[model samples]
Structures are given as structure tokens and as C-alpha cells.
Target: MGLDSTPSRYRRIVEEHFTALYGSAFGRLGQVLAVDAAPDGRRAAVLGEIRSAWRDRPDAVLHLVDLDTGATTRLGDGGDVCPQWSPDGTRIAVATGGAARLVDPDTGAGTPAPPVPGVVEYLQWAPDGRQLLLGVHRPAATGGDAAPVVTGTGADEGARGLWIWDTATASVRQLTVTGAVWEASWCGADRIAAIVSDRPTENSWYTATLTLIEVAGGQRIGYRSDRQLALPTGAPDGSAVAFVECWCSDRGVVAGALKLLDPATGTVSDVDTRGVDVTDLRWPNSLWYAGIREPETAVGVVSGTGVDGDPARPAPASTEVAPAAGSRAGEEIWSGTDTIGQFYPAVAPLPGGRFVAVHSSYARPPELAVFDRAAEPRTVLAAGHDGEHRVRDRAGTLSYVDWSAPDGLRIGGFLARPAGTGPHPLVLHVHGGPVLAFRNRWQLGHPLIGLLVAHGYAVLSANPRGSTGRGREYVDRVVGDMGGADAGDLLAGVDAMIERGVTEPGRIGVTGHSYGGFMSCWLVGAHPGRFAAAVAASSVTDWYVQHFASEIGWFDVAFLGATPDTPGGPHFTRSPLSLAHRVRTPTLLFAGADDTGVPPVQSTEFATALAESGTPVEHVRYPNEGHVTRGQRAILDQHARTLDWFARHLPTG
Candidate 1:
């Protein structure tokens, strides 16, 4: 089958089909961040954007969607804000313009509530709705465009801390002075629990502690995990604080380990969650959670936990969810990987066991939906990005495909292939976080993924060793073995597909961002000639360079198990740049101008080495993009470039 891989044709398809649905590198996209169910469940307030965010504030618009009529109304605009519903649901608490306010959901009017020191992220409304607990991130040392994942610095001005805004007095006060606060929640009216670090750098968050800050005075360290902690939700009665703890390579993107702490008693225990890695949590009537159970993403309730279990005895404190043996927990009411109830699988608890989640599937665009524990979901507000369906249909079938690693471990991933496919050229797409996974969550909606599938190139997105959904042992295995078995697992996946008559040898291309980018470069370099072409975006081509340059240097130190200073370390051996001389595949490199996580130098260094090796290589940079390219034009350009690169190399039919 002959395919047209011209830049204009691919660019047009991306603009007309994808730019409208997901977003274009230029802008103009609606995103739903947080969903709050009204007291009556007739309406929900979504905290996000009705327009392009560009990762900048003043893009936040509080949208009120009537569940019955499916009508959406924007309350107002804000600089940087976290929107939360009052207990009574009469008003919404939001922080914008470096200040907090109470917004009338019906009238779209705002009541000022004094000013705070910084931009608000995670927040909570007091039980009585008279106060707001804000997770405020102060400005960076530069005092311009702060909060992105950048290198750690010593006690700079930029630090995330907690704040309390009293709506009654229209005043706000700082809660703590030391240690930057991240995910936070209010405990009753007098206490707050948060994930905090003594340092404000992105690397420090890897070891941040879960602390309980008292509104009365002192803060106490509640629980400190060797692994990362996040999504601390306070029980309504202020009895316990629940959080998801796990071995995470990246902050914000996490899964598994639902642990509860009774602050008064100072007793912390695991909420037996079978084996599922809880990604997000909500403490309503029951300790509800959304997480990944390998090939499936699920939302459920932890029944044996204090809330639903016998209050006479709290669950036993144990590291049951640790790197060893454990079973899945709670009642898995809903299971599937869609973009819903997310701060990454965010679930908004509605009244009477109903939940409203932002839904997106392999074929569906993002939209609001209501789901009961056992019943199928119904859309609340249509996302209006229906153009994706046609692309989905022609993009072929999406399924979870697993293959045995070279070492006998099973590696799972999502695969999309053309309809009439018999050993089609497979495009391996790697996810960013060695910690993140591809859960069939409308990834096909992505212009690049869809364009490839539409062009008869099967896509393989792996959840190989370091990915979540498989538990701590599985994820932590990548720590000292970043280039070892993890690389073999993905290469073995291509072999599995080959054995299954899915794709033949010498016809595959590889693409990824971040660690995936590292792997793409890793594969082409370490295991030469396995891939026909490679596109590494925001990549780490040289571990030695990455350790000194990347924002989270600890990531390299921790994952590689050796410092760059270590003589003859894997940092020197595993880096793609070390093997660049062996790369015969034409490689295309991409990076963001503003990225600090994996600096543009990471890409340029590899490009330089590849040029020295006489291997065809090109480096492309997005001016306004960051670690992840979210720009409309930038993304579109990436799609066109990726298709063009692969087309010139890989065999289609």
C-alpha cells in the first residue's frame, strides 16, 4: 500500500481532524481540571479552561455545567487558581490573581477574600464553607513564569506553602514558613495535611514528607515514605488523612499505595486495596480511589478502611502495598482506562454513590460523565470534539498487548493497528514518565498516534518495567537497571508482535518523550538496527550530561544507582550518546526551549554526536513549549515532522 507522507498532507489532516479536538500547538482547547458535584447533583462546577491554557494562568475559567440540560456557564476568569466547592455548594472557592475569592456559581459574581503570597494549586474548602485551604506556590527567584519543573535551588523565593483564607473576614494567613507544600487538604477546620519538602526544588519532592500542619500552631510530620506521596485528602470529620504513596520517578504522575493516617491518634495504616495502585483518592462517605491495575484503570472504594470498616478497630498499619506481595483492594465499581475524575483519573464524588468524571476513551474525546458503581456511564456534557471518532474508526483496533520480557517478566502495553493488517510496520510510542503508562485513554486522539494508525502503521505504547499499574517492585526495577531489562522488554514486545504476525522485522519506528525519548535513543544506539527510524523528544541522550543538567538530577542518580562522578558508571555506558556511534537509523530530535526537566541540550548533544557519527540526525526546538510540548502549532508541527520522518524510513506495506 502506497501512502502519501508529504508534510502538507499530514499537516492538513492534523489541523482539520486533530487540532480541533485535542488541541493545536497554536492554542484553543478546553480542559477540565477538577469536577465538583453540586449538593443536589443537578449540576457540576468544572475547574479548568474553556480556552487554551498554554500552561499559563488567566486561562482559568470556572465552568458550571447543568447535568440535566447539559448547559455550561463560565463564572469568571482568573490568573492562577484552584477551584473548590463549599460544603453547602452555595459558592465556589477560587484563588486567582494571587488572591482568593468566593464565586457565586449562579451569578458569576466574585467576592474578594484578601490576597495571598502566591498562585494556588491544590485546595480545599472548610466544612462550613467559611474558609479555604490553599496550596500556594510562590513566585520563583526570577519572579516570572514560575512553578514549572526546574532544577532545585537552595531556599529561593519560590516555594509552595499552605494558606488559609477566611471568607467571613476577607482575610488570608500563611500556615507554615518552611518546606514547600504540594498536594494539600484541610482537616476539619483546625488542621491541614500536605505533601511537603524541606526544599522547594523539583528534585526534593522525590523525598517529600507527609506533614500535618495545625492551624493553631505547630506542624507535625505525619508519615514520611521512602517513596513519594500525593493526593492527601482529609476526612470530613477531621479524623483521618488519606494519601496515595508509591515509588514514583516523576512527581504528580503517580499510582498505588492508599494509606490512611488518624492524626489525633498518630496511627498510620494501609487501606488494603487488593493490588491496584491507587492514582487518585477522594474521602467522601467511603475512601474512594482511582488507580491502575495493570492493563486496566479502575475506580473503587476501600471498604475495609476505617470509613467503611469497623470503626472500633482501624486497619492494621503495614507496608502491605510496598514492593512485595499484595492483592487488589476495595470494590472495583468501575474499571477502564479513560480520562475521567482525574487529577489523572480524577473522580468527583457525587451524592448517593454517583460520581462525575471527565471521560475519554480510545475513540472518544474528553467530556463529562456520570457513573454509578455498577452501571455504565452517561455523558454529562459533550466535549464537542467528536471529529475524533472518524479517525478512531479508521485508526484500526486498540487492545492491550503483553509480551514476555527477555527475563521472563511480562510487559504490557497498548497497541493500535490498521484493520487489514498482516505484519504491518509497527510504530513503538513510549510514554514520558518511565513512571507513566499508556492506558488506552484516547491516545489515538493524539494527532501523531492517529495519523500513524491511519497510515497503516501499528502503534505500540509500552508499560514496560518502570511504568506504574504493576506495583512498586515492577516500577522500582528500573531504578538501577534503566537501560537493562526495560530496554529488552520493549524490544521483546516488537518480537512478540512479530511472532503474532503483527509486524515484521526491519519495518518498525520508535518515538517517545522524556524517558521514552531516552529509550528511543537508547534502542537505536545500544541495540543498533532494531528500529528503522527514531524521534526522541525532550530526551536524555547522555546520562552523564543529564545528571548535571536536568532539573531532577536526583532522578538520574536514583535511577542509575550511580552518580556521574562514579568512574565507569552506567551513566557513561547507558546514555544514548555513548552508543550514538553505533546508530545507523536516521534520528529526529525534538526539545522545548523552556524545558528544564530534560534540557534542549540533551537533544542537541545527541544530535551533535550523531552528526559526528555520520548518522542522519536533525534537532527541532519549540520556542514557547516546555518539557512537554503543549503548544498547538508546535504539536501540529511535531505530528507533521514525525510522520515525515517515519515515512522516509519505515516500510508501510
Candidate 2:
């Protein structure tokens, strides 16, 4: 009845969709991580990974694509290698395995540079192509007073620092004596701009410093502000440097402004971004290009001409220019779509006003596209599968929805409803990051959403108060009140769905991973009667345990304002484990055994509590998996188990 609505049928639907989506000719395109357009504008280099199946580990590869010929060639294996194009477009630099190698774009030939002692964390070719900047990871020696190093979490003891590799002589030299360098860009041949943090911790983003380092003399000129600055790129002439200065209050980045740094004077000036959240800035040519996050996430080009207002003072309101056509100040080259499922769109500028980017919507996989200002965005490489598997029979239509929270704040979300639905069972899917938003991109990580919708279920994915793209104020709402108003915001979204008559009462299930998992646990425990089934993956149960075990334990100080050791702290008061006695819903828990983000102990502790309290619960730990599971088999197993758990506990029809 109603398409069987059984676990076996649900499994079949999931398998069919996963196969149709991954087994198609276009599915081989894989996921594009980074793209760099050559100087000539005739070609581009892409770093992407191909996954043959839903449960297979992705094979990372470097691809050289010809814009004029539309031909693509796969280079050698690129395991987590981020390739960068030389200014002249003759060569590319990438760190493959432990070696930094220079690759010829035309021939796909790689020549090994001098090998650094440790793993390369960051790699970029200098402007002159004579040297490469690298961030290396060297393991600490084992001895008395030497702490054991933790690898995957990026918190290894004195393991990571910056270095420079000379391509001309094949020589390597250490730059920084201590501190972990996250990113570095050459200001010129003799200077480099970089973001350095004390330790590579989970919350290091908040503590990273923007510094201009002299390569020849090893002198450091640091920015004055204490705020987090990122993605430092220098002007071609080395006169100025541009970086995203995250204007964060104790609540996180409330505003991200593109700031210009004078290398000679050590003075910083804010680029009039016209109120847009500038996530990234680059000066590839005479004009400075910025990656915008709010008012629609897209790429915009700004004039590099002199600032009209005072450089040291904040621009008056009158000096600000709105993003409009015919304005030399700034203009969006690519505005995003309002449709659900499109996200993280990027653009790389080539020589002659042409750009290469990965374009896709929620219903479509990413395809490499070329954009010319005069013509429509043309697809250079299309991922073959388009919603062919998502027919009315097995898939639902995705739409954007918004509702007002209890505090009168409007919250946004995406809803995917099954075809021929009438008060169908709904699943509230939460997103992690508490800071991240559920954009319109394809849910590669949560493929089960499609399967669930196909089986007569409705899914509501809400971006509660803490989610990004809503500006700084809304994002800061979750700070120091993690489980308070944000939880209420999620419940408000559920109430809105109920009022819309899209969901049936008493048949709702809840699921999320990481921060979303934490929300799922808190939701089921605080409001047990609202949900029938709950699946929390890599969840944070006790803030106390999270503070002690997580590599990002600093998140406790940032989000909760106190550590677990602080007496009468919010760490225990805000934890979902505190309300474990009230949980009545059948809950499923899954986590990676090696997850230093949330830590496996969080799930284990909660599972023990649930079992002792006689609540129906199950916990599964994926061995060798970290905060995000990259292994194919582990991913498939997680989805299958989650789907089965939901099917057994919640009514699908």
C-alpha cells in the first residue's frame, strides 16, 4: 500500500536513485574542489575527486581543461592537492603526497621540487614562478615532556609551519620558527602575506592573525586589529594587500569587510563593500574581485582605483555605492538563483574577461561552466545526470519556505515534498555548523533525503537563527545560547510546516549530523512527544566532554562563554545529556571513531544514558572515520542504517 512504504522498499528506492545518480555517464565528473584559469584564458586546471559508487572512497585527480577545444585531460593522482596556476600560465604547483611538484599544464608532466620534511599543508606558486610558498607539517619527536601528537585534527604539537621552496635551485627554507600557518600568498618576490594562528585548533579561525612577512629578511609586519582576517592576496605591484577582515564580536563574524593593507606603511583601510559580506578577495588584474556571501552569494568585481573617502576613516553613508549596473565601483558578474539546492558558486577570472566556474543547483550536480559578460553562462563540462532519477514517481519538488520564530525573527528553510502528498509524514533535517546554511547545492552528504521524499515523506530543512547568509545579527543569536533560542527557532519551523498542512501530526521524525545532531538530540529530549524517531550523527551530547575531547574545544569558550571547568557554567546546563531523563523517542546515534570535532565519547556517553533510562536507542561508531566520513563503505552504511531506523520508527505513508 502507498508504494509499500517498507524498509526493504525504501532501501530499493535509495539504491536505484544512488545508482542512477552515480552510475550515469555524467556522474563521473566528480566534485570540483578548486579551479584556476590560466593567464591565456584558453585553458583551466581543476582539482576534483571522482567517486565510482556511493560507498567508494573518492579518487582525487587533477584535470586540465581546454576552453577553446572543450577537451579535458586527467593528470596524475591528486590526493587533497590544491593546484595553483602560475602568473604566466606556463606551470602549476601542487603538493602531491609529501612532495611539492611543478606541473606542466599542456603536457600533464610533473617535476619534483625539493622535498620538505613533512606533509605540505598549503602550496602556492610565487608571482615570478621562481619559488613556491608552502605550509608544512613536521611530526614532533617522541620524548619526555613532549606531548603525543594528534594528526587529523590539525592540532599536532609543533608539526605545522610555513616554508618557502625555491623552484630555480630546488631548495627549501623554513620561514616561521613557530605557530601554524593556514594560508600564505606572495606579496612580491621578497615578501609574503599570510594568516598565522597559535595552534591549528577547531576554533582557530577566530584566533588567526594577518601578517605581512619579509621573505628575504624574515621580518614580520602584523595587522593592528585582533579580529580574524583571512584570504590575504597582494596586489601585483606589492603596493597594497587585500584581506577579509571578519568583524566579530564575542558572537562570531558579524560582518566580513574587505580591508586593504598598505605594505609600506602598515596601515589598513576598509574597502567600501556596500554592506555585502565579502568572504574572499583577489587582485588577479587591475580590478579587485570579491566573493560575496550575502545579498545573494556570487562573484563581484570592484574597481581598484583610489578610494573616494578617507582611507583611515570608515566611509560615510553617502560614500557607499549600491551594487548596480553602470557603477564602476562594484557589480555582480553572476547573481545566484532563488531555487532550493544551489550553493557555493565560485568564479575564476581568465585573461580576457572570460571566467571558469562550477555551476549547479540543488537538483543538479556541479558542472564546469564558462562565463563571458556578453553571453549567457555556457556549460563547458556537464555532469550527465540531471534529475532523471528524480521523477515524480520517486522524487519531490524543492521549494524555499520561511516562517516567523517566537521572537519575531523570520527564519528561512527549504522544503522537499513528495508528489501527490496530502498531510504526509515529515522529517525535520537539521544542518551542522549551527553556523552553516542549507544552500541550494545537491545534498551529496545526505542522499537519504531524496530516498525519504520518494517514499511518501516530506522533508523540511530550516536555517534557524544561527545559520549564515542572514547577516551578522541573526548569526550571533545562537551565541552563548546554543540550545535556547536556536532550538526554539527549529521548533518554530516545524510548527509553521504543521500550520501549512504539509505535515501530519504525531508522525514526524528528526535527523541531523554534527551540530545538527546536537540539535536533534536536544529536540527529542526537550520535546519528546513532538518526534517519533530521532537520528543524531556525530552529535555533541555533553558540552563538558566536548570541551575536553574535541580539537575544537575552543568552541565551548566561543559559543558558551565558559569552559567545562568553570563552576555553574552553561556547559552542563545547556547540554542535551542534562535532559536525558525526559527523552522518550526512539533515537539512533552514529559517529566516527576518530572524530576530534565532536569526539566519539559524546555519542557513547549519551547512548549509555539512553540505555540506562530504558529509552529505545542504538549507537554505531565508524572506525578510522573523522568529523566527516570520507570512506565510501562507511557513508553508505550510515545512510542505510539511518534510513532503516527512521522507517521502523516513523510512518512513511
Candidate 3:
């Protein structure tokens, strides 16, 4: 065995394989992606189960969960994403493997919808439930399936249009042929609201505009976002349109400012969400929203102050939104730190103010539950009772801690301690996307946090200035600063833990992936001899190389404020590889051979620098993997190597 490898300490990594083989998580239930409520609210269609083999892309199957009895039955055929329940709750439309399929929610029997020219990306049923709107993607020049969009890139890489599929006629017809539509939802049956962009490339999403387009042939501009705009949703009656505007570092993951547009007056009003960034918005009773409210996950109602209340009916002279109690971001119905929604927030709104979602924490495993106004969420489907009970007993203490950074700005993080500890060895777990924040959520179906804690390591997840959850102002602070203040936030957090007698100062280590990986690489070099060991997977070691070769080169311009070709600037000084000469820490690096986002060269460049600096380094590149490590065998090996590496360097027992 390699020096990092230790005796088998934990069970063989089998959760992913178990799910793939038995159709269920081995020690836990399935990870809930999104939930859709039936018409009566007594039943719900839940999307769960992510197999290891399909980790390269997200895949889940639909299931019917009984709210009262807490019983679940999986829908037969697997689905890719965007699961929608028909209005009457009779059928559910799920886009499974690039094809649209309808399954009877009760019987779990499925049938294919009429085929379109392109691959189906999104499925949204009409309000009347007679038809569905499909977001079809067919790259302008690519001749094969949309699957290539995952790895390869070219001009107009993700060009998409809309199609309508009729249930009664069993026929499909084109809806819009005009421009690149990123996201679209029904604005009543005849009209649709969509987020449109001029370019079909990934970076073009940064400057997209929210527009209201008709099914026939008309379009109205709603709002043009300075940052990335997404999730354009319209009211059932087509009275108003709502969408989310945020600075997203990664595609498909969105959460931020909530806005309402009165198409009649062409005026957009900001939705006051009690200061929380809206993640998911649905119009059931009024407007129901789920978002990141810093320390907790909040679900609320947006009511009262209507956006011009049909500003176009009589063409109101003033387009100002009328103010009223609960008119802004609405009222908070339920909130908790442990409740989780995969990407952002996923809730299935019932007929009443209550809703259903998945809940998990350091002590409790994931389970389906119902939430009402100000009441604790009632667990309806507790996963793996025996296994969860054992895990809860072994779970020590999880707390939200904060400390002042070098500049006196208060930085926060979640600290998890194992069974018994006093100054336990610390492992700083950094989250991906310098634009994203680390919140307190259960770590299931993945390595890093959960594995570290079980093996007697205390985890300190720092949410620096760049992370979301904090207001936009806080999020905006990390834009151009990148590795400066954000890095200090983590160092300050480490100091805080040492001062509080929670972790040993000299025994601390660090590990992360993507942006987190970048931090890990930068931290070891910038502060040589600080971290005992470092593991940075799929890391972006050099900004110059990343800006020139990455799929989203614009992301560098947005954060670094300059291109790699720009004489000399942050591109050179901010890169970790430039400082590798001073590094003395033993580091483990990983890269995916097929990762187009960070590219494999990022890790290779840093590995070469480490060897040149005489720093102990081991680099591994996995085939068939992308930016995010998802291959089953790869994840299992990663978990084992990470645990062994940490144990070998920062010894506790």
C-alpha cells in the first residue's frame, strides 16, 4: 500500500453501488431531488435515487409518497430531470434520458410523448393539464444527441427552443423558433414567460433577459438582468411574472434576487423576501418561495402587495407596485438549518400553506417531511431507522460558529465534532464555486464531510465573503477579491477554532474540490507549513490557463477582472502554481480526464510545480469523469484515499 493508505477503517464505499443494484440507498433512503404535490395534497410525486454508474450526470426516478402514511412507491422508468405533476394529478411528465414520458402517478405506468427534433431538457405541464411545454435543445452545429454538450464545446453549444405536446391528440408542435430560450414556463395556456439570451454559449447566460412570449408569435420584454437571470415563472392566471436574478458561478445552480414584472407597464419590482435570496418560486395559493436565509432554509408566501394588479388592464399611469403587509417577500411558514433541497430549495406546495420536503442534519439522516407555519417539520418517512439511529448516536455536536476576519468582517461556518473529542484534528472542508456558500446540510451519497467526521475528524466549513446565503452585498464582496479576503476568512476561522479549544492548532488539514480545490492548492502554497496535508481535487491551479481553456472563460473576467493575456496582474500573482516554490505541505491532487470546466491540465500543472518545489504530492486523473467527481468506482477510491491520507498526516489516536 502507498504511504497514505491505512488499514481498512470504514466500511467499503458501497452506497452508490447499492443504490444502482437494489434500487435503494444501502444505509439510507434515496436522496430527494425535487417534490411535486398531487392535487389533493395527500399524495406527492417525489424524485429520488442517484445511482453510482450515472454519476457523470444527474439521474433520478419518480415515486409516489403518501403524506399521511409515509409510504413510497417508485415510478417504473427512470427520469433525467424536471418532473412535473399534471394539474388534476392524474399523470406526471418526466423527461427521462432525453425523451419526454408521461406516467400515471397512481399506477406508475409510463408512456412516451411524441418525439421532437431535439432532445427534451425540460417538461412543464399546462395549467389545464391538457398539454405540456418542452424545452428542446439541439446544438446549432452538433449532429448527434445533446449528450455531447456535457463534454465538448463549440459555437452556440446549447441552443434551445420550445415545443408543445398535446395529450388528447398525442401530437407535438413547435412553440417558438425565434431566439435562444434558456428557461421557459407557462404564462397561462396561450402565453409563456422565458429567459432569453443572444448567444447560446454558457457565458451568455450572464446577460440574459426575462421575456414573455406567446405560443402563437408575439413577445414582450420583461426585465434585462445585469447578472445571470433564471427560473422565469408566471402566475397560473397570467396576471404576473416572477424570476430569480443572481451572480451564478456554475450553470444549473441558481439562487438570488427575486423580481416581479408587470408586462403591461414594462416595470419590474424587486420582491422583498425578508432579505433571503429566492431559490425556488411556485404560484399555488399566492406565490410560494423557498430560499437561503443565511443560517436557515426558509419557506414563505409572497402576497398582498400585488405588482400593479393588472397594470395593463386600464394602462395605469404609474407602474409602481402597491405596498401591503406580507406583500413583499411574503410570510415565513417554516424554516430549519438541516432541511435540504439538492441544488437550491425544493418544496411541493399543497393546497394549504403547508408543504413537503426532505430534511437532514448532522444527527438525522434524510427523510421526507411536511412543514407548516412556524411549526417544526414532522418527519413522515424516516430513512434506514436502524442505521440512522446508530448514526445519530455516533453524531456528536454540530454548531454554527462565527469569528472576525483579518479586516474585522464577521465570517461564519458550521463545525461538526465527532463522538468524543477535545482539540480534535481539524479538516477544513471548502465548498465549490467561490460564488457558492457552505450551509449546514446532511452529507449523503458523497465523500469528504461525512467520511471525515465518522473517522474522528472535526470539520470546519468556512463561508467566506464570496458565498451565497448572505445578502447580495456580501456575495458581491468576493467578486474581484477572489483569494485575498476569502482566504483570510478561512484562516480566521481556523484561529477561532483553536482559540475556542475545539481543535488542535498544528494538526489541522484541508481538502476540497473545484473552487474549494483552488483554495486548498492556494492555501498550502500561500501559507507554507500551515496545513499538515492538503487534498485538492479537480482544482484550478493557474488562472491564466483556466481563463484561456475553460468552458466558461468569462467566469475568469467576472471574478479576476482581467484576462490571462493582460500583461501582468492577478492572473500571475493570484495563481497557486506561482507560489509552489515555497510550499512544504504534503498534497494530494485529482483531476477528471474529461473535465471541460477546470480541465485536467489544471491538476497536472500544479503537480509539476509541487514536484519542482520538492513538496510531497500525488495526483490522480480518472477517466469518464467531469468537473464534479461522479463515477462510482472513482468516488469509492477517492473516499478511501482521502481518509487514509488525512489519518496518516494528522494523527489523532
Candidate 4:
């Protein structure tokens, strides 16, 4: 059968196509950072990473994925990510394993940065590129006293400090001895813009504060924001620094806005963030470039320029929807319908003024396309699922369906039901980054949607508020309001599918990871009569306990509107643990042992609660994993378990 005509066999065909393209299904393009052109602009050297990020394997290698020809050259083994070429483009500096490396782009080799034991982080390169800056977690004093990770952060604890390195000399310089410095950028060879925070102790959150430091003269310039901000990117001209600002609200963490701070003047101004929460901040020019959100994704530009001036000024005229004032805008680039809602969208401008956008989806593998304002986008290099081959034999379709919610918000989902099947057992594949949206990029994996469809099962992945791709308001709609609005949206979607004859009500099964896992637990417990069985991985059941154990402590205060010490509000009302008695569905709970973020306690609690309530529940734990399942074996095991659970309960769709 031809690629476009074959719908029933899409899943198996894609698997074969992907295995032929990339050597393994783990060809996950890790991080795309610091893209620049060669001195002559003949070829652009793009620096990126593809590593076992969640797994943290020793073999993780950062590679330079060529934009023009789709050639990938390994940059050697190291913890390298976020590569920045020198002003001369002779060398590329990157955050390698525990340090940094300055490699030659042509040969894919270079000198390594001095290693710093413990916590190592990515900083930025100077405009000259000769110098690199980074943050190294400073160890506690030796002998009598020692501070642990549980203690959190504190002064005198020798928290993560700033460091400067000379690429040419291979010399290192420690800039600070106390507090934590993150999102560091070199303004010039002599100056730097870095965000600093101090804590009374390593384990304290209330004592944290943000500070902007002028590193050239070692000046401590105290600057404050209404909330926490991260990933500060410098403007093209180096006049301002843009960072993400998050605020706590009754609903939960409402991303306030992207703001620009003038390091010289100590002034802060809000950028128009549109309604979508800014996923990334990039500057092709000082005035504007791009901001990315999931679903209906578009690259928008901000044209106006001024200090503390009203960002609400006249909006730019374009087909794109720019962010609102006090927010950031997306790049002035356009991707295809395939990339719109399927995966994370990334863009890098080639040396010749053209741009390359790379995206990956659950329906397809990673692919890169180039575009310019004057010309249409061209697929310069298609993604190789395995080694370096492109999969042209696989084809699929993407559609958005709306399910009504009681909150009056229209919750939508991306459904990739195979074109050939109908009465198939439907697979309710939930998304991971509950804060993220599922896009329409090329996909290859267990082929959740395609595999199920190929295996005679319909697959539906819904966006239950709190999901990105939509504007900020929509994503925040489920903050402290979890289980409140999104849970309703899930049920509505399931019902809608049943009504459309796309899914069998009794044969439906659900599975999700992270926040989706939490939702799965919530669904089985809150509305047990609907789904026959479920698989919840890295989920949270008791919000009260999870809020404290997870690294995202701030999230608890934000999600619940109050901490555990003073509970009993909207958070508890929405907690699935409180509704344990209502659960009737059989469930399989999966957890990662090392996950302090969601904490294994969540799954344990759900299993305990359900079993005690006279419900059948199975708890499976991975020894060394944290938050997610890695390796083809573990992933396959997870899928197998999911399939087994549903097949045992909801058989014969």
C-alpha cells in the first residue's frame, strides 16, 4: 500500500520506517541551543544535543546537526549542551559533562573546560566567544559541618557559584563563593548579567531572593521581581536581559509575563506575552524575534522599542498572534501544519539569513526544515529515526476535537486515530508535560496512537487546560483548580468519543505519565465508573504530602493556594486522595524510585488507598529510574503493562 493510502497499517509501517531511519527509537534530539553561522556564511554550524537526558547514561553525546544538508557530526563525549560559537566562529563553547568544551566546528573536536565536581550548570559565552561563563555548585565547608541537598540553599553553604573560563588558555576563575547564580550571560568580555538567589539554609524556600549582579567590577546590585524567573536570555544588542516571571495565584502558578531588565539602569519592563505562557525567549533582534507555545503554534515578532514604555502600544501587523503586553513574542518564522501541535518547536537562524526549525511529534520522527521571509519553507533535512535515514513511507493525520467542560472552557485534544479503523479498542493516551501540549510532528515510538490503531485500537490525547499550546489563561485554568476543570474535560472527551462511535465505552483504557499520571489517578478515583482500567506513572494522589516531597515545592503552594501546614482549601477539594472512597476501577500504578519531583509516594498512596477501599490495584516500581521510564526495555515494559491491564479488563471492544 502507498504511504498516504494505508491507514490501518500505519503503526507497523512507521515502526519499520523509523528503525530504518535511526538506529534506535531513542534518537531523541535532546536540546537545541546556541546556533550561529560560520565566518564566511557558507555553512551554518548548529549546536545541539541528543542524550539519555532522563536516564543520564554515560554515553550521552552532543552533536552539531547540520542545517543545510542534514548532516550530524558528533562533538565528542562530554556533558556538553547549549553551544555558543565565538565571535570569530573558530570555536564552539558548550556545557559538557560537569564543565564546558570549546570545540572546532569543522572537525567536531576541541579543548575541554575544567571539570567542577557536583552541580554543574550552563552559563553563556561572551560576545568575543573567547571567554565562557558557567555556574558550579560550591561544596559545603569541609570537616565539622556539611549542608545536604535536602537543606536546600543558604548563605555560607557555598551554593552554586559563578565561574569564568578563557577558551584559549583553558584557565578557570571562580566568581562567587556563596548563594546560587543562574542564567548567566556575558554582556561583553568584561561584564556579565546573572540572576542570584540567597537562602538562610540549604533547605529553606522562604529565604530565597533574586538578585541581578554586575560581574565586571564585582558590584552587588540588588534587584527584585514579584516572582521567580529563570532562563535569562540576553537581547541581540546586549542592552537588556529577558527572563520568565511566574506568579502565585488562587488558581495556582500564573506565569506573570516575560520582562526585560536593563542591567545598566536597573529598570524592568514587561513584554507582551500574548495569552500563551512563554515557553522560550529568543532574540534575533533587540526589539523582537519569537516566543513558542503548543497547539495553534506560531512564531510572532515584537517590533516596538522603548524603555518602561507601554508594551500595549499598537500591535504588529502579521498573520501571527503576538503575546500580550508584559509577555514575550515568538520568532518571525513559520513551520508546516505537521509541526504546529505535535512537538516542541525550535528555530535557529542560519548564517545566510535563513532559518531552520526542528520539531518532533508522537505521530512522526524529528525533522528539520528551512525558511526565509521571501521564500517558502523547504525540507532541507528530514529526520532520521534511527541512524541517518528519512522515513517517507509513513503517513498519518492529525485533528482537534473539543469536549465541553463545566467551567465553560472549551477543552480540546489532538486525536490521531488511524484512518482505517473505527470499532477499535480506543487508547486514551495522555500527555506527559501536563504543562505542555501535544503537537502534530512526526512521531515514532511505541506509536501510542498509530500502534493502537494498527493493532485495532483508537488513540486519543486530550489537552485538559493546564496544558500549553493555548494561552496562559487556558493553561492556568487548572492550577489549584486541578481535578476541578481538567478532570471534567477528560470525561467529556471520553463521552464525546463514545458518541461519535470512535471508541467503545466499555473498552476504553487510559494511561499517562507525570501530571497525566496524576490525572489518571484522579480519573479512576473521582469518576471510577467510566474507565475499566488505568495505568498511572509518576503520579500524585495526596497533594498534601506530594507538595513537600517534590522539588517543585513552590508548585504546591501555587496549586493548592496554601501549604500543607495550613491546608483545607481548593487544593484538598481537588485532591484524588480525598475522593479515594469513590474509586472502583482497577488500576496499575507505576513509579520511579529516584523521582523527588513527583515522588513515588504519589503512586504508593493511590495503590494503598484503592486497595484499602476494596479496589484491585497493582503497584510497580523501577529501581533506578526517576520521574520517567528510560531505555527501550523499560519503555517496552511500561507499554506491555499498559496493554495487559486494559486487555484484561476492557477486552472485546
TM-score of each: 0.91, 0.88, 0.90, 0.81
* Candidate 1 per-residue C-alpha lDDT over 261-364 given as tens digits, one digit per residue, 9 for 90 to 100: 87877777766666678877875445678877877667777654443432222233220211112332577677875556433577777766678888877777
Candidate 4 lDDT, 331-396, residue by residue in tens:
344434455212344445443345556545554455555666568666644545433223322323
Provide the overall lDDT of each model, using Cα atoms, as 2-decimal numbers: 0.75, 0.70, 0.76, 0.59
Q: Which stretches of candidate 3 lie over 4 Å from their true place?
A: 1-29, 50-59, 139-158, 305-327, 444-446
TM-score of candidate 1 versus the correct structure, residues matched by position:
0.91
Tens-digit lDDT track of model 2 for 235-261: 555666777765342222233556677
How many pairs of residues in model 3 come into backbone collision?
A: 3
Which runs of model 2 end up more than 4 angstroms from their true locations? Answer: 1-13, 25-28, 52-56, 140-156, 200-205, 224-227, 247-255, 272-275, 286-295, 305-329, 338-343, 386-393
Error of 1 at 290 (Å): 0.9
lDDT of 4 at 439: 57
| Candidate 2 weakest ten by summed lDDT | 309-318
Give per-residue lDDT, candidate 4, residue 451: 40
**Distance from true location, Cα of 627 in model 3, Å:** 1.0
The TM-score of predicted model 2 comes to 0.88
By lDDT: ranked, best first? 3, 1, 2, 4
Better of 3 and 4 by lDDT: 3
